[model samples]
Target: MTHHTDLLIIGAGILGLSHAYAAAKRGLKVKVFERTATPLGASVRNFGQALVTGQPPGPMLDLARQSRDIWGQWAQLANLQLKRNGSYLFARTEAEEHLLEAFCAGRAEEYGYRVNLLQGAAMNDLYGGQFRHHRAALHGLDDQQLYSREALPALINYLCRELKVEFHFSTLVRDIEPGQLHSTAGSFRGEQIIVCSGHDYQTLLAEQIAELNPQICHLQMLRARPKVDLNLQHALLTGLSCVHYGAFADLPEAAPVQAQILRDVPHLHEHGIHLLISPTPYGELIIGDSHHYGSDPSPFNAEQVDNWMIELAEQTLGCQIQVVERWQGVYGSRGPGPFSFLRAADGVSVALMHTGVGMSVGPAMAERNITELWGEV
Candidate 1:
C-alpha cells in the first residue's frame, strides 16, 4: 500500500516544519517524515535565538526578520513558551570596545538594530555587576529567544492537532524521486516533495551538495547551574562575538579586533571559539561553543576546549558555575552563502541552511519556496 498527500516533506526539522505550516495554512494535505522518533536535531540544539541583529545584511537579514514575524505569529497560535530577549555583547579589550562603538555609531541604528552602548554603573544595573572586568557592552534590544527544545514539540503538537498535518516518525527515506519516496515505514507519494534534512548530505542531495564543497561544523555546547541567584536579563555575548557575527565582523573597527584576538589567543581563534550564554526557561544557563570544521573531523571532543569555555564563562559572569551537561552540535557549513535551495532534475527540491541560523530564518525561507510553488499562503 502507498501513503499519499498533496505535499510530502522529508525531515521534520525547522525547515520542514515551516514548509508544513506554510502548506497546511493554504488548506493542502501535508505529510512529514522524520528519521527520529521525535523532532530532534539542530532545531533543538541551539540557543533558540532569532539572531536578527547579526545577519550579514541584505537578503539574509531580511529573511531573518520575516521568519521572526512568522515565529511570533506561530508562538501565539501554538502557545509556544517564548521570550523577547535582547543581547548584551560585552567587550573584553580596547579594540573590541572601539568596534562596539563603531557598530553603534552608524550601521547598527541605521539597520534598525537599536543598539545602545552602556558602561560602568548602567551596565552594572543591568546584570548586577556580572562583568566587572569588561570595558563596555552594546545591547541589541530587538532579538528574539525561543525555548528551543520545547518550541519544536509545541510546534509539532500544533501541526498535528490543529493543522491536521500527518507525521511519520522514525521513517527513513531510503530513496526519493519527483513525487514518490521509499521509506522504512512504507512508500509515500505526493504531488510535491521537499527535502529539509539539514546536514545529512549523505542521505539526500549527496551529489549536488557535495559538489558545492560542503563541510560539517562540530560545535561544543554545555549547560550550567549558577552558584547564586543571578539575573540574566539578556543573552550574553563576549568580545569574540564581534568578529564572529556578520553584522559587526565587516566593520573597519572589527579588523583590528579580529587581528588582536588572533595574535593574543590563537587557540580560541583556531577552534572558532566564541562564548554565548542564554538562559533556559528552567533558569539554567546554556553556554557554548567552539566550531571545528571538515568533511570528517574527530568524533571525540577535546576536553581542553570544554575547560577553556567553562573558564571563560566563569570569568565573564563573576561567579562559579557547575557544569550540568555537555554535548556536541553538528550543523552544515556556511558554504559560499547563508543557505541554499537546490533543485533536482525530477522536480524535487532540497532546502538547507548553511549555518545554525535555521531556527532564525527557516520559516521565511519556507514561505518563499512554498509561495513560489503554489502562490501566496
Candidate 2:
C-alpha cells in the first residue's frame, strides 16, 4: 500500500516527535515512521535533564531555553510528569569552585541566567545538609527534568489523539529518493521528508555520514532505588561536570579544574566520567554517566566505570546507593554545536548528531526547521 502525507518524519525519537508536533500544530498532515517496535534510543536512555543553564552561550543556549519552555507547555497537554527541580553543581575542590565562580560571573548576564555561588549555610540547604562535602556549589535555577520513560509515551499519545498525527512503528526505511521513502512496510510519499536517525548513520545516508566522520559516544547510566526517601530538591552535578560541559570549558579557571581532576582522579579523566544524579518522583535516583567515544565501542559495560560512578555519587551525596538497574546509550557526536542538519536531496533534510542534548534542544530545532520549510509555523 502507498501512503502519502504533507510531512514524513523518519525515526521516532525526540527529534522526530518534535517535528511531528510542530507540523501537526501547523495543520500539516504528518506521518512518522519508526524502525523499531518502540521508542528506544538516546532519547529514552538519558537523565531526562532539560539543562538550559549548562549550554554554551549563543544560539545553542537560546534553543535550549526555548525547548525547555516548550516542554513545560506540552507537559500539561501530554500529562507528562515534568520536574522543574533546577540543578546544583557542587564543587569538591577550590579549583572547581574557582571555575564555577568564573562561569557564574562571565556568562550569567549574557545568557540571562540565574546562578548563585553557594557556600556555608546556602550550600548546606541544597539537599537539607546531606551534602556536607566541605566545599562550594553553583546553583542554576533554570534547569528542569522529565521522566523520559513516561514522557515519551505521553507525547506520542498526545500527538496521535489530539493532533491526528499518524505513526508507523516497526517500519525500516530501506531507501529514500526525492519526496518518497521506501520502507519494509510500503512506500511513503510526502511534500517534505525529514530524517532524524540518531546513531544509525549507515542505514539512511551512508556516504554523507561517513564523509563527516562523526564520533560515536557511548555512555553508561544506572538507576538505584534508595533505601530511604532522599527527597532531593534538585538535579545534582559534581565538579567534574565543569570540564565535561562546554559552557564551563571556555572559562579561564577551567584549565586549572581539569588539571586538578587529572591529578587527583586520573581514571575519571581517562574515561570521561562525570556524576549527575536526578531523583525521580518515586524516590529512586537516576545516576550516570561515563563517555567513551570511538567509531566502534565495546558492547560490554566496564565494571570499573560503574564502580567509579557509584563511588563518586555516594561520596558527593554523602549516602550509600544500591543500584537497581544499569544501561548504556550511544549517540552521535560531532564536536560543539546544537545539531547537524544536512540537505540530502530536494525537500529531503537529515538531522542528527545532537550530542546528547536532544531532549534539551530538539523541540526548538524542529520548530526552526519547520519554519524554514513551510514558513511561519
Candidate 3:
C-alpha cells in the first residue's frame, strides 16, 4: 500500500512523536513510522525528568522551559499523571557545599531559574531529617517528573485520537530520499520528512551519521521497590550531579567540586556515575545511572558500578532500598552540544544525539525544527 501525508516522521521516540504532535496541531497531515512495536528506546528508558533547572543558559534552557510547559498541558488533556516534584542537589562535603552556595548566589539567575539554598534546620524542616546530615542542598522548585512508561503511550494515544496523526508500528524503514521513505509496511510520500532516529546510525542516513562519527553513550539504570512505603516530595540528586549537569558545570564554582569528586571518588568518576533518585507515584524509587561511551559499549552490566550507584543513593537519602529491576540504555551523543541536527537533504532533517535531555527539551526542539523547515507556520 502507498500513503501520502503533508509530513512524514521516521522513528516513534519522543523526538519523532513531538514532531508529529507539533505538525498535526498546525493542521498538517502527519504520519509516523516506528521500527519497533512500541517505543523501546531512550525515550522510554529515561528517568522522565522534565528538568529545566539543570539546563545551561541560552537556547537549550529556553527550549527546556517551553517543553516543560507543553508537557504539563498535554498531561492534563490526556489525563496522564505528571508529578511536579521539584529536584534537590544536596551536598555532603564542605567543598560541595561551597559549590552549591556559589551556584545559588551567582549563577542561578543566569541559568534562568530560581533555586533555594537549604541547610541545617531549614533543610530538615523542608525535606525532613533524612537530609540533615547533608551540608547543603539546592532546591529547584519547578522541576517536573512523569513516568515515561505510561506518559509516552498516553501522548501517542492523544496524538492519534485527538489530532488524527497516523502511526505505523513494527515497520522498518529501508531507505529515505528527499520526498519519500521506503518502509517494510509501505512507501510514504510527504512534502517534508523528519528523522528522529536515535543511536541508529546504520539505518536510513547511515552514511551521513557515520560522517559525523557520533559517540554512543550507554547507561546502567535500576528500579528499587522499598519494602516500606516512602512518599518522596522531591527528586533527589547528589553533589555529583552538579558536576554532571551542564548548567552547574559551566559555573566557575563547579571546578573545585569537579576536582574534589575526581580526587575523592575516582572510581565513580571512572564510570561516569552520578546519583539521581526519583520516586514514582506507586511508591517505588527509580534510581540510576552510570555512563560508558563508545561506538559499542559492553553489553555486560557492571555489578560493581550498580553497587556504587546504590551506595551513593543510600548514603544521600539515608535509607535502605531494595533493587527490583535493572537495565541499560544507549543513546547517541556528541559532546557539549545539547543535540545534533543534520540536513540530510532539502526538506529532510535528521535530529539525533539529544544526550540525556530528550524528555526535557524534545518537544520544544521539534516545534522549532518544524518551523525552521517549513518557515513561518
lDDT tens string, model 1, 1-377? 68778898999989999999999999999999999999777788888878777777788788988988898899899999767767788898889989888878778768777677987887776665667678898877667787778899899999999999999999998988888989998998898889988888899868887877777898999999989878675788899988888889989999999899889888999989999988887878989999998886467999999999999899888889999999888888857678888776465888888887888788999999999888985
- List pairs with backbone clashes in candidate 2: none
Candidate 2 on 94-209: residue-level lDDT in tens?
88887877777777866688788898888777567777674998878788988788889899999999999999999999988888999988998899999998888778888877
Alpha-carbon shift of residue 111 in model 1 (angstroms): 2.2
Candidate 2: minimum summed lDDT over ten consecutive residues — where?
Answer: 333-342
Candidate 2 local lDDT, residue 210: 76
Displacement of residue 316 (Cα, Å) in model 3 is 1.4
Per-model C-alpha lDDT, please? Answer: 0.86, 0.86, 0.85
The lDDT-based order of candidates, best leading, equals 2, 1, 3
Residue pair clashes in candidate 3:
none
Quote each prediction's TM-score. 0.97, 0.97, 0.97
Give the lowest summed-lDDT range of ten residues in model 3: 225-234
In candidate 3, what are the lDDT values of residues 262-366, reduced to their tens digit? 888899999999998888778888899999988876789989999998888788777788999999977888743778778989878888854888998999998
